[model samples]
Target: MTTTTPAALRAAAERFGDGEAVADGSVRLSWHDLLTAAETVARALIAEGLAPEDRVALCAPNTHHWVAAVLGAQYAGCVAVPVNTRFTEPEMAEILTRSRARALFVVGTFLGVDRLARLQGFLDGVTVIRIPGEGDRPSPDVIEWDALGAVAERVPVEVARARADAVTPDQVSDILFTSGTTGRSKGAMTAHRQALGVAAAWVECGEVTSADRYLIVNPFFHSFGYKAGILAALLSGATMVPQAVFDLDRTLELVERERITVLPGPPTIYQTMLDRPGKRPSTLRLAVTGAAPVPVVLVERMRSELSFQTVLTAYGLTEAVVVTMCRPGDAPETVSRTSGRAVAGFEVRIAGDTREILVRGPNVMLGYLDDPEATAQAVDGDGWLHTGDVGVLDADGYLTITDRLKDMYVCGGFNVYPAEVEQVLARLPGVSECAVVGVPHERLGEVGRAHIILAPGTSLSTEDVLAHCAERLANYKIPRSVEFRTELPRNATGKILKRMLRDG
Candidate 1:
């Protein structure tokens, strides 16, 4: 069995060989090519004197280099710390500092910004490897991506391969940082076995195969995009076509051009594709989405108009990816209403009183990196991970996420889950996206406030929103106030920054 990621790469190279592993723009690498590249990266790390389990950070987009760089770190028996590309300098610096990353693989430029230059002050003593990007210039003290081959020549290929073979399943493979919605982001440490376990489980549930081509629109930094997207493709032999940034036109073009068979993203991705100007024929077969409410109407539209045969909704956090996933051939209503039963060998049960979803599983994270107290609070003595989100499991084992525990607000002694309210608001015409947050109220202590992003060229009055909610929801459940915006603030993943909304 391929227990570690490096082992998986070797197995992939042996099995798939020349099969296309990654397709990023003009760059395409076969499985054998990918393995060779990763080995070269491992050799480079070895030459740099990075010890076993030492941290290396990759803060680039979902390009092929991001894929190769991370795999190379694993191949070298190093723990990869994937930094969010959307983070500000301070946030990036914090992660680099906290993770104690000895080397950094960052894009030279992205979206007219020099990401490395921006972090000049914080990158002291960190070995910087610059990946080619738009309008980038040569810099001192930074290793170019192509120059890794030369640095790697110092260490023999046999040495790197031996190091990769020695990596144990129990060793920490990667440290994935949380979105930090509540406070400081916690790095969730996942072992080689656990990471592969989740990917294999996702592969089983999604029915992924070697023939499938996966379009990875999700950011590589997030678990959904990294574990479920890149790693899943690696395990299943699916071709990974990464989209650095989500451009509607570019995504549609790639879907048609690449004959993309599997596309997984948040609900907004499908909705945006559905709302595109004209129908673009696609071969999209499987779509796994979550992170927010997926309306039944959207599911129906995705099947009917978007031509998706199987759409699965899944629920997971950074601690454990692929917790529950709706299986293939499930009814649209089933896919829309619930995130499917536990996969990845997870035992799921709702905590008695709080109704917080607790999971005990092989794929569950070992613990938060360097945060013992937080780790203790999250995982109990019984080995159940106390997922902070509130949810209910149905008779058939379907899991319905109600809301985050912190997002629930009491109105006149009545608890209102923002998800339920948001679901109702999603059905409203002209409502492109909506978020319900509890705001300070003098009498009720807390009242729901709706922040809406209207569909383009569409308009809705405060009364229009209130009247619609009044008809569907109870008086207390209705938002006391409504605010419209061009766009809602979201983190690296599509999850809304509810804390920001609440603060506003």
Candidate 2:
């Protein structure tokens, strides 16, 4: 048996043929139907003469068809590159050029902009395969999402099966680009075995099973959503319900209507649910949340008021899909405070002096695609991937991320990690969310300044926040000033845009 994603999909289909596999609003496909659709698209690629190992870019939102295209690429033995939906025209072109994607699977119109038009200059030598999203109409020079089956019907299905079977563990499965928060993004090439290991790890650590229903709100382009969210469901035989964008009311309705058992998202998702909580899903059994600081109170509420059987928090980067996950029976403090212990088959250690988190395991990427220097800088010569994020591995091996190396600043000879300060603020009364950045200070060279979000109808003065921090935190770690806002800005993945805060 192959360990690739396509192999997993076929196996799941055989076991759960009639069970729902993926749904995007109006369309919900069973495992067998979804697999058959993907295989049809795979054969279409072969009919069009797309060679094995060729690159195929999947640039779309969270749609069932997007899932089909990714599996199809795997069946065709082509490298699937998931492009960021939030990327601008230049960023999109850079990835298309960088990955050298021979074929492009793009959303027709997203956020009122034409994606195909967005890639006009970038399509100089690329084959465009358009997948129309809601409200999109037909145009020339693009293949319709459903038409691929009819076009590929001439090619025998066995040919696509043979191609999928020939895939090796070491071949590139996908090239995921980093968020490029610091600089230009580099494509992290993940092989079949590595990607499989990551997905399998999530299934085991997350305790996901066939009875679970996953509502995937994270964009499919993100590895968290692509590998851990989608592929993990395939591995566990869980039903997938894809949500393209996160609308609180709509999500609540979907959860209740579909009997969603497993829901994973960032802090924002839960915060919104807590604020509104339209209707508690009768089947909400588990919640695996990360990508932001989880206030201790939030975890308590999820397991109690939200009626989640288990609540878990995990930590990982794109280079490593899921490094650690809090276990099912962990205490609320453990789930909220730490990122849990390292997942099976991976080791986590803090650098000797810098305290930078280092990870080594089967899940680490092969390398940054076509960028040896960047690869060397990230993963050292000794095979340990030097994650730039600073963290502390407790005695029990539970890791608590303190801050990014780039985000740390020294104030009056004391180092201050923004996450540490932010956590202290998160516990403050009436605080919904907060961000801390080191601003230039003449006396100390730099001082921590906080931007805080207050809950609706709740008032928190800067004096109250500062006084609360003074009692709980050290002087150097405390923010020198505070600025209140309706909400903090976030990136596509729901991570706070600290750079934007600093720039402002």
By lDDT, the best candidate is 1
Give one digit per residue, the lDDT tens place, for model 1 in 446-472.
789999999998999999999988765
TM-score of candidate 2 to 2 decimals: 0.81
* lDDT, candidate 2, 1-504, per-residue tens: 347877888898998889889877788899999889889989988887789899999988888889999999988999999987766676688889988888999998877768787688778667778888668777777778878978788899999999988888889999998634334567999998888888888888778998898999877888878888888888888988998877888888889888898888776677678778355556788888776667799898887777889889998877888899999899999998999998848999999889999999888989999989888988998889987889998889999988777676656433466776777788887998888898877545578999988988899888999998876554666899999988788999998888889889
lDDT of each: 0.88, 0.83
Top model by TM-score, which number? 1
lDDT of 2: 0.83
**What's each prediction's TM-score?**
0.83, 0.81
The local lDDT score (0 to 100) that residue 147 gets in candidate 2 is: 86
